[model samples]
Target: MKDENIKTAARLLLGTGLIFAGISHLTFARKDFKAQVPDWVPLKIDDTVVYSGIAEITLGGALVLAPKKYKATTGKIAAAFFTAIFPGNISQYVNKRSAFGLDTDGKRFARLFFQPVLVYWALKSTGNVK
Candidate 1:
């Protein structure tokens, strides 16, 4: 298949998958994910987990249904969001705990590093995006 098609498929898969995941996390991982929140952060409000879940769902929707614009804008946004969340993954690893049912060990740490790659892959599939 063509690269664009591949990228689109990947974007759709990742985006839609994350949306579902956010829904699940919002519905189920609420208390668990909240407990795992790092202590160094000062704003330990009770709403962050659900808010973050909403953000994830929004991002996933944008990625899945992005209109043609500034070359791979959606992919770039998705990638950046993954980068932003990298620290949370690290916290999970350090605490040896799972967040949102995601594994949290050596394997999880490794997976944490790949989210950026997924974003890049989706962008690169477009072949014309920067």
Candidate 2:
């Protein structure tokens, strides 16, 4: 496969993940997903999680289904989408909650630390950053 095709496939995978996660959050596991939100947050926790989930799924669908002609924009949207949800990852660690049965203190930072790399990947592939 060409480099562009490979990048497109990876972008699709990112979108796929968001779609699956959003579906889970909007469907059967919203409360569990919200459990990670810190009490200090001002908004209604349930509303926040559910809304975020919906947004994620919508953006994910856009990314995955986006035509090859729109890969650049779609990738940027996916990258920004991922960046936005990152705080939830932090909330999970702070609340001592597991996201998908893999939640643990040691594992928390391990995953959280990759925010930069994810961001970079998103930027480089999507042309958001040099």
Candidate 3:
């Protein structure tokens, strides 16, 4: 069906985006990513960034390569991952640590709203929602 096809495309795009982001976290954007790590987190900021980068890469791979029967499970995991990382976004805003062009409080605050959209996208694209 047309709807299914659309979902498929969206899922692929999300997966690819995640992969790209993960790469950035480990490489070119590593310092920018550290800006998002909350001070309360115990790990060294660089370590946190690296670990999260790996997680993102794994989740992205799962989203792209998960079999049809496992799509919903992958979706749930992806959604949870998105939820887990939300605090980093909050940290970026609260600490006034600018990254990804969210240089102002208003922009950082607005970026907070996008996390839920990613959650929804993960679920919907994998057919975990109608």
Candidate 4:
């Protein structure tokens, strides 16, 4: 596929993934998501999860529906959001808390590597990187 086509495809996929994840956060995965919240976080765990879910839904929808002129801004926001949540992922790993079947230390450790890729995806897919 051509470069723009590839980016469009990636952006669409990322948006869909986030939307689904946001839905999961509000519904079936509420408890699982709670496990991902860092213990040191002062906010109520469930409330934090809900707020993140809402943010995910809003950001995902923006990625899919925002006009071309706003793509870069949306992408930057998405990237920042990804960066913001990364500490939760680290908490999960460091605390040895398992959810979504990332039970093993290796699996949790490996998952940490994917966060940066997600950040890059948000940037690249919206043409913020190129």
Q: Give each model's whole-structure lDDT.
A: 0.69, 0.75, 0.95, 0.94
What is candidate 2's CA lDDT for residue 85?
Answer: 68
lDDT of 3 by residue, 1-130 (tens): 9999999999999999999999999999999999999999999999999999999998899889988999999999999999999999999999999889999999999999999999999999999999
- Which segments of candidate 1 are over 4 A away from where they belong? 99-104, 125-130
Q: Number of backbone collisions per candidate, in order?
A: 0, 0, 0, 0
* Best candidate, TM-score: 3
Query: Which window of 10 residues has the lowest lDDT sum in candidate 3?
Result: 58-67
Q: Which structure is stronger by lDDT: 1 or 2? A: 2
User: Which residue pairs in candidate 3 have backbone atoms (N, alpha carbon, C) closer than 3 angstroms, thus clashing?
Assistant: none
lDDT order, best first, reads 3, 4, 2, 1
Q: Kindly list the per-residue Cα lDDT of model 2 for residues 14-128, writing each as its tens digit.
A: 7788789889888888877886667777889988888888887887888778676776787677677668767877888877887666467988767788776766666566545
Query: What TM-score against the true fold does each predicted structure earn?
Result: 0.77, 0.79, 0.98, 0.97
Could you tell me which 10 consecutive residues in candidate 2 have the lowest summed lDDT?
A: 121-130
RMSD to truth, every model: 2.9, 2.5, 0.6, 1.0
- Model 1 per-residue lDDT at 44: 54
Kindly report which residue stretches of model 3 are placed more than 4 angstroms away from their true locations once superposed: none
Runs in model 2 lying further than 4 Å from the true structure? 124-130
Name model 4 segments beyond 4 Å from true: none
Q: In terms of lDDT, which candidate is stronger, 2 or 3?
A: 3
